[model samples]
Target: MSAVPAMPAVRVAEGPVRIALVGSPNSGKTTLFNALTGSSARVGNYAGVTVERREGVLTGSHGGVRILDLPGTYALDGETPDEHVVHEVLHGAVPGEPIPDALLVVADATTLRRSLALVHEALALGRPALVVLTMIDEVKARHGRLDPLALSRHLGVQVVGVVGHRGVGLDVLRGFLDDARNWRVARVPTGIADAGARFAWVDRVVHEIGADVLAADTRSDKIDRLLLHPVAGVVVFAAVMVLLFQSIFAWAVPAMDAIDTLFALAADGVRATLPESWLVGLLADGVIAGVGSVVIFLPQILILFTFLHLLQDVGYMARAAFVVDRVMGRVGLQGRSFVPLLSCFACAVPGIMATRTIASPRERLATILVAPFMTCSARLPVYTLLIAAFVPATSVGPVGLQGLVMLGLYVLGATVALTAAKILNSTLLRGRVSVFYMELPPYRWPTMRMLVRQVGQSARAFLRRAGTIILAASVVLWVLLHVPQAAPIAGATPAETARANLEASVAGRLGHAIEPVIAPLGFDWKVGVGLVASLAAREVIVSTLAQIYAVSEGESFRGVLEAIQADIDPRTGRPVFTLPVALALMVFFVFALQCTSTIAVMARETGGWRWPAFAFTSMLLLAWLGSFITYRLARFLA
Candidate 1:
């Protein structure tokens, strides 16, 4: 190792000194970023990728310091989009962003040898650099010894050890940051040619500053014995997921009912105070019904996120990924693809963005193309509504029939995604399979603060979408259903008049035009209109249905469900929403790429129209086929 000349001091004139936190995936970088800046950036146990760059202001005795949490990457050589972003940001190539004044390279103490390559790369950047060793407690628990002072002396840089989740050694770490002048820029040996040479140098440093003969972590190993046991591990994972989905239904019912009651009361108050007019109808049916229908699912979304964060915090996500790697590998994806696929349950937009962490371009593209099949939260409202209306709520042994049906839908999505990945990898996106490597962090109790923060962030995002996109779609649908009204029939109720107007309006004509195409799948013209409207967002289907039905019956969510159950077909004189039709609708939602936001994100991520267009066409075809088969089978059985 050679020592480079010390660079001249650079000082900020007034504002906070900008610092960048960079590290490999699963190296505790996010935890340290959260600890230092009080930011609630998402953290996961698996090799999760952050798509967006987050910035926070850290305050201390030295005053406010700006901290930017860059996406985690294994190298600075720009192999992945995340790596490219970090490379650009550090070089001041990112538009509208200045070069960071200093760099903090976070490394996992348990895997320091593998982590050192990136640390070496960061040091080569010639910026004021410091190394923060996170998860030191895990190292000690495994009887590993690390002397930070010795490492600092050997490397010619400041070194600090901290347990980020527990907030240990943070004060000492803060003290080092408060005095920025003492920070050193690392000198790299000029002749080092390749990764092998880099690893050789890292080996020498580790031998000199880190202890040999570190004991194994028996506790983690023992837990892994069961959690990673091929059959047992998979069983446990299945059980955990089943419980999670079951709770989403069972636990959210009260909160959802409360929201429904509140909205119903508000609508009643409006109708009572105002005379029958277009304004009253618009407010009660368009705004209240549309927005409230989507908002009622908020409880389920929050509950789902809470469970996800808890699993991530407790460190089981990595083990779960490991257990599924073999199955994923057979489909040309590594274990890293699991997290992003799982994220699709929340929304495909983020799920597609999470592919940046995947190193293999082919694998990443395959993951993105199939992610929409993962049954996102937006589809939950439709699923719940159909399940409640048709599926019996009887308990099948230990589980509710409705919960089992919900779980089956999720499993069906996963099955299709894996199959699609296999087909794509074998044909359009075929490439060499990449090896999977992951570190399992020790399990710890999740902090309430962290859990609360994550839940709050997810809830706010869901509400914001409902407020903007869904609200707009609702108003548009309302106008489409109300315009070009025919003269009112004498001796008819307001509900009858509204129905008559809807049948004569533009929306009705469009729906009827498409009804012939979807008739084979057991959907009516009204449901066809919803299918068209849901392109903006999957949850918009719920709001669209609510608006259309509310204008006629002026009913609450439960009442609407009952009304749909009793709806008679004009030709067959049977209930419109039979068991077969409801089941077919659920199957259609399970496979459809109905969310336009997802399509837009896919376009942006893939950097063109081709992939997104392919995704939309393929998924839409599959949805129609799947719904047709399901409807046929269900109708035969019924």
Candidate 2:
């Protein structure tokens, strides 16, 4: 860890004023950040829907200022990881990070009591914090008014009204931050009071502030009634999800094709230019083909995130959580689990990180255990290719029948996870009362900068994963599938002969020996060989299978798919991947915890190998059993 500078460091030249906005959950803190920062930060449903942070540079008279949007929480008692990060930021305890020169605490005007809990906690930390009462429009519309002067006098902090979404009251907030010395800690009552004392202070402040203003309907409440209606809300939710999945297919197809064409052109160019040797073969056939196969899916990945970003910007994520809370709870999950589970829809790493919002250890653990079951973007390419090949595209009513199958696979993963969670909650992870508090934040338009940052981050993360573990594994698989000659006897060309000799190699023999056990599961020795190689990454199975089935016929997308479809056992004269085999493969993929990145994340998040060990063992076991049963059922039915 690096050390924090002795003082706040800024560029010598004048830049934007570095201001940090802090607030309790649903206090409109982010709205204020969006307002002040001009919505420059990307908005998205974070790993946990409960808390999300955004940052942007704000232009000011003095210079450019850096602004941070923090997760909303009631207090800094450090009840959860998100709260704990807040505690650290205020005290300058985060490694190598400077404390903010000014703190802006957004408070909900209507819920003065609930919001003040965070204000008092921030004040106690002796930081340069001010109170910005948000949702004033909502308050006034609801017949609530606050006396800024009295509230400031009582709280000993500067108070300002900020309608963050509309850019209202920001100049006053900025003018206050221009001078940090004016900020001071709130003075406590002369003597300590009972547990209710804090509540009493909250009530007194509201009364002095003239809490009630008008009885008219607030804009937010009116909007909520429509968006949160039980029936209308769920219909809208399903529509949005359907739209997102459809967009991934329809919007991304052209871009994906373009990428594929470009890579194919590059591979052909390289092969033409370079001498026909192992090094060129490695680049053209092994590295380029294997990695490019995955990288081309970036278009689909980007499209998936774009929809997620839009949903978050519009603030319907919280409502989705509320709508799904009943279903989640029935599966022994907290309402808070909705965000993390939804996050797992993208990737399990962030989902595990999002578990920071769950206060109970048991709930967090259960969430982590089931996170990997969520269909992540990594699995999408394999699923897409297989489904496209096997499942015919047709309409089921108004819906694309292929898309419904895709949706079914996602639902399958989620259902298995929820079931697994229930079983675990009753056994290994049972205990403790789970709290389900969260704020349904108001919607805002997503800024361009925020969208770019989020998409960039997601893309970079995927590339990094592919570069490190996947690259190393691919090279090793290349060698295992390529090296060691069986015998150099007859008139076979080197190209034909080299790989055939691999059967005498260590990897091939092992795969051959294991073939009998997996034969019933519809896997050949070559498939067994790919599986062993794919202990490194499940997606690699496709590329490895492509290579294994290619033989001396040469490789192409159509050729590989045809070979896969055409594969048959010499003894049975039956296709290797029968419909049952394909169905079983799908089920196995649905339940298997195959990503090494997810495993490493679990270890880091849980602070040990114990949790990851448990996760790996149980998920793999379940995957095996589920696939075996699926294979048998398919065969019996056939």
Candidate 3:
């Protein structure tokens, strides 16, 4: 282990002053950071959703105060990765990170007792310290009295109370931040190195100020009575998820329709204005049709992100995790696994990263292995495309048939993941389930500013994927589908000639080579090609299908799917993409380990390719088996 760096004396810096915000999780530190620096915060490194550190500048007339929002840590000891990062940041041991000149201790006014334990640890670092009491509005609502003057006098550190989200008392906080040079030094209490004594000092300070939890938490408690009930909570979560899926299809129609029409017109204009050539075909068919099919689902992605952010901001997510802890017990896991799996709904990469919080290595490894089975945003385009084509939009009571299908797909994914973890735990990765302890945050109305910022970030990330990975893949597939063009037959009609050309292309041959392997799942050569192409990214399948089905699009929106539904296979004497095939396709997507990035991340997390290889092989076999069963069942019903 490296020697700990000596503490530096507080002095004015040549550059902007740096202040690190240290607090326990859900103490309103993030809200305070947002209040201090709105929309100016930037995340570094891999740009994945599993970010731990953020930096922002509090711009004021006096100067720019750079604020470092470290990962929320319960204590200074490095038991977990988050806490380790906190320890490193404070000690100036993190490479490429400068030592912070001061520390801002943020504590929730409703839960200050345990929070002060963290404060005791932070002040021991000997940096200039400021304690900001967040959620002061809730503190007042409960009729709880807090004397900052008294508290500040006791700790020998300045204290300020502010409702971070509401902008209350920000002026006083800003005034203190502006005069960074003359900030008061925190005096660490003597002979209090022991844990009991440290907290005793904390208790003395709290008692002197009469700071204690009052009755306002009951509002959250009352709401949680139903939201956290063993039976009722699960039901409510299911209903909320169903509504969320319904909104994905219902709320996105107008925007999707507009995008569809715009892309269709653009394609038509390109063909008409530009001369008939391979370049025009490349632009109109390859670029417009291929990319537009996937882009039309952007509205649905935005809606999903909005709902996710809303639930997270409202603090219901923790309750949901708590509710699921029971189910985790039966599966030989714990609520800690559920939190990472919940994150998997966004992306498995982050979900896998979140398993770092799990102390048990075997349990953490199990969580990482099964995380990819959770339905992610990348699967949305594929799911929506097939559901929209096969499932009717008619409502069953208050829910649409399409939405119920979407919800079923999500539930199926999660159910299978849990089952997989159970089997793994019983067999190869068997281990004892670890204890899970989590703090439930008080419910509050989400601010529109924070909502917009979060959704905007997710939206930007989606567009980036569309532009980079999807764009390159589409171009590559287009080249494969169009290369080595066939000569026109003397008596062939345009449709016949186009079909012949497509069949003779490189992609066509490649698909045919794998047709025998996938035929039992009711997929044709074109779908085989799509399955292969989508390995780059799941949404790439929709674009691949768009390019593959560009033969006869009338309006270029739903008309494309209508044409697809109308397609016939001469060999089978049936519609190419029938209901059974669509169902089978969705099932296949639900289980297939097709993402290379996921594979890479899994390898990195597991310390080798051994586990990733095992996961990929197992999931691929399961995908085939699941698809075969769904196809046979649908065919029998038909």
**Highest TM-score against the true fold, candidate:** 1
TM-scores of all predicted structures: 0.81, 0.77, 0.79
Model 1 TM-score (2 dp): 0.81
lDDT of 3 by residue, 188-214 (tens): 675566778878888888887898647
Mind giving the per-residue lDDT tens digits that candidate 2 earns over 1-638? 36865443445223444566778766777657766656356533223323344677664633356777876667766566667677777777766546776787788876786677667666665666788998787666566667777788887888898777666788888777666544776664533244377667766766666773456455557778887888887888678766765676578779878987887777788989988876776676567666665576677667666666666667776677678778878878876687677767656665676676565566777898899998876677667766766666889999997798788889999888899889988988665445567667655666776677556766776676656655555566666665664777588765446546556656677679889877777777876776665555677667666656644434534655677788888988977776677777777788878776678667756766788898888887887788899889978988
Q: Which has the better lDDT: candidate 2, or candidate 3?
A: 3
Residue 154's lDDT within candidate 1 is 68
Task: Write down the lDDT that model 3 would get.
Answer: 0.78
Q: Model 2 — which ten-residue stretch has the worst lDDT?
A: 43-52
Residue pairs in clash, model 1: none
Candidates' RMSD to native: 5.9, 6.1, 5.9
Q: Write the per-residue lDDT of candidate 1 for residues 307-370, one digit (tens) a residue.
A: 7778878888777767777778998887768867876776675567567656566777889999
Candidate 1 backbone overlaps, count? 0
Task: Evaluate residue 536 in candidate 1 and report its C-alpha lDDT on the 0 to 100 scale.
Answer: 60
Q: State the weakest 10-residue window (summed lDDT) of model 3.
A: 43-52
